[model samples]
Target: MSDFLIDEELLAAIDMGSNSFHLAIARLDHGEVKKVVSMSEKVQLAAGLDDNNNLTDVAQQRGLACLSRFVGRLSSVQANRLRIVATNALRQAKNGQDFIDKAAKILPKPIEIIAGREEARLIYLGVSHTMANGGRRLVIDIGGGSTEFIIGEQFEPIYTESLQMGCVAFTNKFFADGEINVKNFNKAVSAATKELLAIANVYKEEGWETVVGSSGTIKACRQIIINLGWSDEKQTITRTGVEKLKEKLLKYKHISELDFEGLKEDRRAVLPAGFAILYAIFNVMDIDRMMYSDGALREGVMYDLLGRFKHEDIRDRSVQALVGRYNIDIKQAERVVKTAQKLFDDVAESLKLTNEDSDLLRRAAYLHEIGLAISHGGYHRHGAYVLEHSDIPGFSQIDQNCLSHLVAHHRRKIKADLKNEVLKVGTPALVYLCLLLRLAVLLNHSRSDQMLPAIELTVLNEQQWCLTVSGDAKQWPLLVADLHDEQAQFKHWNIDLIIQSEKFID
Candidate 1:
C-alpha cells in the first residue's frame, strides 16, 4: 500500500474509449513491454450522451460498473504505476468533472481526458510498434465518437488528425432508425467523405507504404470480411473485400434482416454505419488494404509510462521544442533549473514530495522564463498564459494547468483572493511547490556563476518552514532582500518562511 513497497516495474493502462473500456497490464522486460493481462468491456460511454453532451444516468451507471470490475482486477497495482485515460466521450461531456469526481472514488488513479490530437498520436504509436516497419504507414482507429488518422514512419508520426466521425455517433445520426437502405448508407458515407476532403489532398501527397487499422470497429470488419469468404484466411481486411461487403450490405434493406456469419450480436446494430465510413475512407484515401493491430491507446499508455520511468521522457522533448520555437535563452533556463532543483531537494522530504513532483518542478523551472521572449514587464503572467493556452504535446490539460500555476506565481505577490482558484485543484502541493520555486529564484537573483551559499530547508510543520543559509552575512545583500520579500508571499499561503544565517547565528 505504501510507496516503498510498490513495484515500479509493473504498469497498467486503462483506456476508457467511447465504445469500449480496455485495460492492459504489462511488465517492463529490458526496454520493451511484455503484456501480462488484458481486459475489455463494452461500456459504450459515448452512446450514453444526451442532446446537451451530458452523460445519461444509465450511461454513468454502466461506465462506473465497468470501472468497478476493472478496479478489482487492478487490486495489486499501485496508483502511480497506473494511467487511466478517457477519450472523446469525456472530452465532449458538459458535466465531465462531475463524472470524473465520482469515478475517482472507485478507481485507483486519476483519469486524464486527452485531446483529439493526443489521441491520434498515441494511436499511431500503438499501431507503429505492433506492425512491421514500412516507409510511411497510415493508421486509422475508428471509435464510437471519433476516428483518428495518422501517418507515421517507424515510431514517429508526421501527420495526425482526428475526425468527428465515429461509428456510434454516425450510427445515431444517420442510421438510428435501423433502416439499412442505400439512401441512408450514401448519406453517412458522403458525410464522412466530406470530413476527409480537407485532409485527403495533403494525406495523399504525403502518402504511405501501408495502411493499418485498430479498435473494435476495424477488428469486427476484418472478422466479417474473412468469414464471408471475401478475403483469405489471414483475417486482414482488403479493399476488394470491403467492396464485396458493401455490395452485400446494400442487399439488406433493414438491420433486423441483416444476419452475417462473422458479425457478433453486439456489433450488428452499428456495423452498417461503420462499414459506410470505412468504405468511404478506402475510396477517398486510396487505401487498398489495412493490416489490423492489437495494440492501441492502452498499449501506448503503458509504453509512455515506461518511458517516464526510464528517463526517456517525451515531456522533456516537448519542453525543448517549446524553447526552440520561442527562441528562449538556453543558458538562463539551465541556470534557473540548476538552482531550482538544488532548492527542491533541500525541502522535498520535509514537503512530502515524490520524484514525479520533482520532475514537474524542474520542467517548470526550465520553462518559467519562456515568456521573456515577449516582454520583460509582467512576463511571469505572460509565460503562464502561453503554457495554459498552448497545446504542448505529451502534456494533459491538468499538467498544463499545474505548470502554468507555477510559472504564474513564480515571481508575483501571492494574493489571498486567488488562493481558492489555484489551490482548489492542486491544494497544499502547489502551495508548497510555489514557495520552493520562489526561494530558488530569489537565491539566483544575480544569474551569475558565482557559488551560492549552502542552504538547508526544514519544515517545522505543514505551515512553517525555515531556510538555513551558511555563509558570510555581507556576501549577498540583494539575495537576502529578495528572500525577505518572498516571506510575504508565503504568508498568503499560510506558511511562515524563516531565514537563518549561520554567520549571524553564532
Candidate 2:
C-alpha cells in the first residue's frame, strides 16, 4: 500500500514464460486496468536448459538482455507496483537461483518463480476477467515448458493442474530436429496424452459449459486455423479444424519446409509442436471447440496487484482459510499476530523490512501453530511441510517458502545449520524475523486473555536486541523460563536477546 497510488495508478507485470518474456503495463481507472504498454521477446529460456537442468550461459545472457529492455519500458512504474513471475523453466532449472541472481541486477524487481497450480489459478483469473461469466469453463494454456489446465466457474478455479509438457519443451524432446513426419508427430501427441492421462477422467467427469484457450501457442493455433479456413464461422477452434491442421502438418517432413499464411516467422518453428499438444488435448479431453482469449497470466498479475492495492489481498484470504481448516486457536493466533506486528514495527526500519516482509511475518505468525492440528509433537516441522507443499492460491512459491522457514524455526532449538538450510540468502533478516516469532510464541505460551504488561522491543544493533517487559518477573515463571530459552536460541543464531523486567530495567 505504501508504494501504490490510488487514482490513475500505474501497475505492471512481467510474465517470464519459458518461450517468451512479456511485460504488461496498465493504468487503473476506477476498478479497471487500461493497457498502457506491452512488450515481449522470444527468450526461449526453457530451450536453453541442458540435460543437466541447468540454464546455459547463453540462455542466461539472453534472458538478462531482454529483462534490461523490459526495464527501460518500466520507467514510469514504481518498483513496488510491479510483479515479475517466472513459470516452468525457472521452476525446473536446478541452477535457477543463479539466473535469478543475475537477472535481479538488471531487472526492476525480484523474479518470483510460481508453482504450476498458482500459474493455473492466475491463468484462469486472466481468462475469466476478459470473457463472459456464466457457466463452468475449462481453460488451457500451452506454454513453452509447461501446459496449464484449469476448470473453473467465472474467476474461481475448481480444478487446476500444470502438466510437465509444453510446446518448446516438447519440441526439444520430440521434434528437436524440426522433423514433422507422422512418427514424430504421433510421438509428441502420445507423450502429451500420457501426461494428461492422470487428469483426463476427472476433468471429463466434472465437465464444462465452454472451453477457452490462452497464451501465445493457443493464440497462434487459433489464428492459423482461422486463416487456413479450418475453423467455424465464429472463428472458434473446432475439432474438425484441429484434425485438418494435423493432416496438413504430417504432409511436411520438416518444419523448415512448411509455410502458412498467418503464422509468423518467430512462431513457425514451434507451431507443429504446439499443434501436437493442442491436438492431443482435443482428442484426450473430448473437446469439441475452443475459444481464444487475449487475457492470460500477465493480465491476471495486473488484476492481482490491483486487489493488493485495494486491501483485497487474496493471500490473506488463503491464510485465513488455512487457519480455519486447521482449527487453530483463533485467540492465540491473534495474540501472536498482534505481538509480532508490534515487534515488527519496532525493528522494521532498523532491519530494512518492507511492507511485504511485514505481511509475510504476520501471515506466518497466524499460521505458526497450524501444525498442531497434525500433532503437538514436532508440530513446527509438520506446519512447515504443510506450508511448503500445500496449494494455496494467490501465494507464490517464494512466499510459501519464507513462511515455511518462519514456522519451522518458530519454536525449535535453533540449529546452527538450520539458518543456512532454510534460507539461501537473507539469512540474517529471516533469522531476525524467526527470532521475533519465537519471542511472540513464547510470550503467548499461556494462551490466556489476561492483560499483558507493556512490552517494548528495541534494536540495539545488528547483533543485539533488547526487550523490556513491564511485569512482575516472579509471577510469570513460565514466561521467564521461556524468555531465557529464547535468549539461548538467539545466541545460537549469533544474536544477543537481552530481556529486562521493570525492576531490572530500573
Candidate 3:
C-alpha cells in the first residue's frame, strides 16, 4: 500500500488507557471500518503515579518503551491517518504535559488528552458499532484509572459520564497490601457504590433494555465465571454467577491464593478490585446481566476518524446544535462564515494555514455571538467560557480551548496572554484565524439582508497585509470607521494591516 490510500485505506487509533495502552488499525471497507490489527501493552500507567499524582520516571519510561514498540507496528500508517488519545491517568497527572512533551519525540502524532465526558462518548461509539441492533443499551467500561457509564442507542449516546473509580485506582486504595479480606473488599465495593450514587438515579430514570460491559475488568470477570463453572451460559455474566464468585472470592484472604481457570496472569493483581467495582454496579443499578464487547475506546476512535475523512464531522453537528439552542441569528452567522472563509482563502498559503484552521475560523465565526444568549455585557467572555466547558461530542479538550480563544477575542481587544494558550495547540495558525474571524465579524456589523460590497484581502508579506473594500466608499461609513479604529490593535500585533477602500487611498 502507498503512504496514503484512496480506497480500502488504513486508519488507526490508539487508546492510552490508565491501565493498558492499545493500538487498533483498520481499513475503510465500503464505508465501514474493518479491523486489520489490534495490539495492547499493560503499562499500568495509573499505578505509576506517586502519592502526589505525578507520573514517576519509571512509569514514564515504561510507557515510552511501550510506545516505541508500537511505533514499529505503525511504520506503514500515515501520520494524518493516526489518532492518539490519553484518558484519565494522563488527565489526573500534575505533570501530564511534561510526559506528553517527551512522548512527542517518539509517537507518530501528538497525544490529545480528552475530557472525561468525551472519553465516555468514544467508548459508547465503539460498543455501538460491534454489537447487534439492541435497543437502548447501557454500556459500562472499567479501566485502570476511571470507569465510564454510557446509556446509548445505536451510535448516539443519550447520557455519558466518567467516574473517578477504576480497578487499578481502587486496588491502590483498598488492596495495596495484596490482601482481599471481607472488610477491605466490602470497603472497596462501598467506595465504588458511593461514586455511582450521584448518577444512579438519572441513569435509572433513563432506563435501558440491555446492558453491556467492556474493556479489561469485565472481560476477565466473564471469563473467570465461565471457567469456574459458576455460569452455564458461557458468554453471559449472570447474577447467580456473581454471587457464587463473591462467596468464593471472600474465602481467600489474598489475591495470590485465588486462582480460576481462564484468568490471565497479568490481570491477577487488579481482578479483586475490578470485581468489587462490578459488584457495586450490579447492585446500585439493579442490573441483571451485561454482555461483554471486545470493542471499546480505540475502535470508536477509528470510526470517528472515518467520519472526519468522509466530511460527516460531528464537530459540525455540534456547532449547528449550539446555533439552534442559542437561537442565534442564522442569516448573520452565515454572512460572517462566508466572509471568514474568503479571508482565510486569501492569506492561507502565506500564513501556512491548513484546512483545519479554515474550519476553525468558520465555526468560530458562527459561534462568536453565543454569549449574548447569557448576557450582552462581556458576552464574548461568557461565550468563551461556554465553549471551554460545554461537552460537545467530538471536540477534544484542546479543540474546545482553541475555539474558545477565537470566540473570546472576536470583537474585544485581544489579550496578550492568549498567545501562550494558542501555542499549546502546537500551531501558530490560531493567531491568523483569530484575525480572520475578527475582520469577518467587523464586516458584517450591519447584520442586514442586503449583502455588503465585494471585499478583498491581500497578503503583502509575512508581516504586512491589506484589506481592500470595493465599491463606493461613501456608502460604507460604519465599516470604514471600524477599519480605521482597528489600526491601533494591529500596531501591537506585529502585523502592518492596511485597510482602505478601492474608491479611495489610506
TM-score per candidate: 0.93, 0.96, 0.96
Task: Evaluate residue 403 in candidate 3 and report its C-alpha lDDT on the 0 to 100 scale.
Answer: 92
* Candidate 1 residue lDDT tens string, 152-222: 99888899899998898998999999998889999999999999998999999998888889988899888
Give the C-alpha lDDT of model 2.
0.89
Best of the candidates, lDDT:
2
Measured on C-alpha atoms, candidate 3 has an lDDT of 0.88
The per-residue C-alpha lDDT of model 2 at residue 450 equals 82
Which lDDT tens digits does candidate 3 get at residues 1-506?
A: 12224667789988999999999988887777899999989999999999999999999999999889888899878888899999999999999889999999999788988988889999999999999767999999999999999998889999999999998999999999999899999999999999999999999999999899999999999988888776655368888889998998899888898788778888989999999999999999998888889889999998887778778788899999999999888999999999999989988888888877877888898899999999999999999999999888888877888899899878877656666666776477887787788888988899886868787888898788898878887787887888877766665566778976658444
lDDT of 1: 0.84
In candidate 3, which residue ranges exceed 4 Å CA deviation? 1-6
Clashing pairs in 2: none
Prediction RMSDs, each to the true structure: 2.7, 1.7, 2.1
The model with the greater TM-score, 2 or 3, is 2
Local accuracy of candidate 2 as per-residue lDDT tens digits, 161-265:
999999899999888998888888889999999999989999999989999999899999899889998898889999999999889888888888878887788
Candidate order by decreasing TM-score: 2, 3, 1
